[model samples]
Target: MSAVSRLWRRAPLWRLCVYGTVFFAGLAAFYPAAYLIRAIPSLGKLHPGALHGGTAPDASKPGPGPGGNGGPPGPGDGRISFLPLTQGLTRAVPFGGHVLPLPAGVWHPVLSAQTGPNGAMLTDVYVRTDRGVVSGMVVAMGTAQPIPDPNLLSVDSPCHDDRAYARGELPSGENVVSCWAIGATPVHDAPGTLNPVVAQAVDRLNALGYPIPPLFMTMRWMHLTTVPKKGVGLEQADVMLSPAAPGTIRLPVPIDQWDRGAIAGAPAAAHFVDRMRVWAQEWAPILERGHAGTLDPTTIPDSLTMDPAAPAVH
Candidate 1:
């Protein structure tokens, strides 16, 4: 027992409480700020091809790995390499007796279930960009609802009942199902118009020289899914494209004013279909191949195309 023991005994409880409170308060403030910075566009640097994930490396010229970045993985390399808004990275996940090719910045994993019994599993990813929000899902030999009929497509959102459905087959024979609908609500009625987080983000964006337009637009949703032979499984991607509603408050233009044919023929609607077709063509062959690794299935040892121990695909 020395001077240190005496000092410890004299330390006031109030002082300790103040220090603890400050530390916890700092932590509480830090996390939400970090999340918003990532979630909000303009808050972070926009990677190239924000709409389609970052632009893919030039196929004409040789580059490094899947993404064009050459050097070894540094500290910045995340565990999954699929972080939200991260561009120029691609991964192939094995599923449903096939592989799901995750497009570069376009598909960022939001949630994934651990491989369940008998190779049952599910994965969900999203791409939020200035034009729209795209959601991609993969169900590996698991039960999921079938694609909705055209009339029922809008049931999931505040969209009108009238929807347009389109179907086609990829070059590789995979089935493609698509539907589009217009949202029904107005922007002012949508939630989060007055949210403090949203307001602060808008202010920061404008301060950074990115001016936001009036929060109104025609909200359009397109849901597309690729079906494997016999409907064994599916890879689904849907996009909700808003013309004017850039921020969180997504309200729709009045349906009465917009002709039904006009909505289907809009430029945004065409763009959504174009993107979906590109994704379907790129992914169909990969799904039938049933391989996720860089090396060919024939070259790999144990003849295992996917994970050996986990049997990720059926």
Candidate 2:
């Protein structure tokens, strides 16, 4: 402060000139800087849709007729509707050998329908896999139809054909095959004990008139490499079964119960009850017709009674 005061006192006019130059320079820089900041698309505080020329007219300030292009309705104008299909779903059955229940639902409509080359559709069955969401539009069809190879549906590896409906592939037109239980990877925490219950259950289901495809039985191991800091770490394991395709059977268990068991040994029983309720409440009409020619629900086993020392059925 002493040195500054001395200098200012010695050269008052020079100091004034210097201060004036600094003040002008700051003032000159401010407007341009502000203009540049505003020029940045992301940095600007403008509403994104409005900035892109998508302005909706203010209805409060009324203008033209009812049919006028009031710039497209704002968020909730009833333009979109979501409805669950209330018809033709099969009853959920117990997954043959294990305490796990099979998933119950109709074949997702989009997955069931035939789509053209560039067509896209959303599916309701959401599976959270090791891969993120595992979402996106599948190529509907192409110029040529790919051959129906059994290997194409393998769950052990990534699917090569990402198309929803391959080009030239014919729909079997058989609606009875409502679901496809393909690529079910098994998770056996204790291999020797209750694991074989799953396989036994499959056998029991086959005896009870469900088509337990060979592909569905091929179980793969899921591995998790990262150490989970909180909660239960999700391993890369899943039982892939299609809920479309007729003659295909679904077990009544929700996916969560199948992934991990409840504290009590009653998930399988709960699944069976829930499935029956769905059948009674939703599919009663179609179920009465016996889609597969008089289904005897009584033939299905309610529980798997097994000895602890029994041999594994792998």
Which candidate achieves the best lDDT against the true structure? 1
Off by over 4 Å in 1: 1-91, 94-97, 114-121, 128-164, 170-314
Worst 10 residues of 2 by lDDT: 305-314
Q: Residue 116 error for model 2, in Å?
A: 48
Clash-forming residue pairs, model 1: 53-105, 53-106
lDDT of 2: 0.23
For all candidates, the clash counts are: 2, 22
Measured by TM-score, how close is model 1 to the native structure?
Answer: 0.31
Candidate 2 global TM-score? 0.17
Count clashing pairs, candidate 1.
2
Q: Write the per-residue lDDT of candidate 1 for residues 12-67, one digit (tens) a residue.
A: 78568868999986544332232342344232223322212322111122111111
* Model 2 spans > 4 angstroms off: 1-197, 217-225, 228-237, 242-245, 248-314
Q: Residue 91 in model 2: shift from native, Å?
A: 15
